[model samples]
Target: MEKQGVEVVVAHHERATLRAGNMFLKIDTDQARAEIEIDAMERAPIPTPEILWRRPPVLALAALSGTALGRLGEPSTASSAAWAAVGAAVRRLHDAPLPPRPGSGIDELATELDTECEWLAANGVLSTDVITRNRRIAEAALRPWTPVFTHGDLQVAHVFIDGDEITGVLDWSEAAQGDALYDLATLTLGHPEHLGDVLTGYGTAADLDVIRAWWSLRSLRGARWLVEHGFEPNSPGCEIDILRTQALRA
Candidate 1:
């Protein structure tokens, strides 16, 4: 008999996700984080994969139906309406009741920015000129914001859609009370050209400069994490590329 092939969902720094048939097994070293993700899913307004089962270091969930909004390096083939749907979904999420935790504070993020910039320079991961220039840009995002429920790692890959409707939002482990602009910034990180569509559906004016600042902030903060996790932020269509693009726009 042929065995069902196992698919690697994601293997990263802290976790490994795999799928066999309709069930996915997410194995993590941090059980508390998994519990938090489960809690967030319960409170979230939108759809998430069904929790088939759970045990320490692993949780099993059913696979979802739709394709992701887009990948980091690829152009979104989804309609503008699809992007709008994501915007609307994010708005609903922000409006939902606050999660039990708060994300990183300004001081923490500032400290992270300094440390990551130094690491990048020390390791020769990026040029000092690139690091210094983007550091200045990232400073603007350190201001206070009225916190909202945030999908802390709201990368385009985490959002799934089918025909202009968001099917599910994934990876709730990072969900926490945080700035709404951070969510917006994360969604449109690599795709600035789609910012207007997202903002249109978001139905409000925001600090464009702050959002841009988040681009640098997010990229800098993530570079180390990605490297530690056996990924490269400097690859085309990745965080370093986003930073390069941001610099070009400056």
Candidate 2:
């Protein structure tokens, strides 16, 4: 038998994910988050990674088949039907029973957004025009919203697909009761071209303005963290470009 080498999937201060053979190990410093992830996966109606075993800070999972729908700063090669299927899957998750823990409140998000925006401007991370325009756009997301079971960090890379079918979704640590649109926005953050395809399967007409607002809000709130985490937020089709596109459209 051949030995399977371990591959580092992702590493940062908060958590590190490693792939060894057919198993994926997620090591998180905060066990509470891991607990949440475990609970959420057990409760979620959609397909998730199989929990192989757990030991405090490290949780192992069986690998899901297929490739990620897309990645940040890159174009998606998935078919429109595949993107639509993901939207339908997300809708099912949202329409399911709510989780026990609630997500961040509007006041909390507003406070964080303000702090991050200030940091971006002070550190000259973005131009005043870009920051100001996106800030205004971000405000639309701060309004009251009904909470649902949300896959809180539904980045394009989290949802895996084989052909036009969704195989499984990964990363449930951030899952909670939250705004459904926020999940939609996060999924299409860097891939705006697929918004229509997604909405087609969502089965409800969403507020386009609010969706755009979330695009801005998420970028503004996450830019600083991404930079500090040694990730590039300014890559093509990523956060910085999203902000600049919003500004140009204004």
Candidate 3:
């Protein structure tokens, strides 16, 4: 039954998401991940949308109340306090009970980075100088970190905020045990200006160098993923800009 009000929210190789009024319907290729999302949200110590129904590829959730922290490739109008709120929310999530599953291994990411960096260089999508230098910078994040309950894909669009309060965190498919700085790095990836604001709210001593390294690692791999996922990496505040910025850094 095709009625009005339902519209596409996100579409990628793994899944397609739609928004129908106050309902969010996700059709995922990985049913196991869908199950994990439902469980993770239930365990997270934050305001998450209620799961309404779940049946194989399609799962429905109630809409969280509030606007997203910000969109990708755009300037954030959200206040500094709002950013701080996100940091506080993340801190709580890190302090929560760990999920049963673990996130990507550091070795896997290191290998992926090497492969993706090679692809970029071979295809001339990005200059060799930029890719190689950033690859070197990315090495800092390869070390060990105390695993915490992390929102594996903690991007700006995933976080919802109302004034100085974090209303909810969305997209739990990638939630697992991982580095806490990686979450902060993901949230502030392209939005470098907000790093300090988030850190102020995080209220913990995090390694900025490691966070910056994660930014490089993310950008190095993101270009190809964006193309494959039908997204514009060259758009403002996206991976392309982030790479350019990384190249200019000391």
Give the winner by TM-score.
Answer: 2
lDDT of 1 by residue, 1-250 (tens): 8789999978977789998987889999999889889999999988888888998888998888889999887888888989988998888899999999978999999998999999999998888888888999999999999999898999999999999888898889999999999999999988888888888888888899999999999999999888888887777888998887777777
Candidate 3: C-alpha lDDT: 0.90
The lDDT-based order of candidates, best leading, equals 2, 3, 1
Least lDDT summed over 10 consecutive residues: which range in candidate 3? 1-10
Clashing pairs in 1: none
Per the 3 Å backbone cut-off, how many clashing residue pairs does candidate 2 have? 0
The most accurate candidate by lDDT is 2
Q: Quick one: ranking by TM-score, best first?
A: 2, 1, 3
Off by over 4 Å in 2: none
Model 3 per-residue lDDT tens digits across residues 139-230: 99999888999989999999999888889999998899999989999999888899999999999988999999999988898889888788
Candidate number that wins on TM-score, 2 or 3: 2
lDDT score at residue 245, model 3, on the 0-100 scale: 85
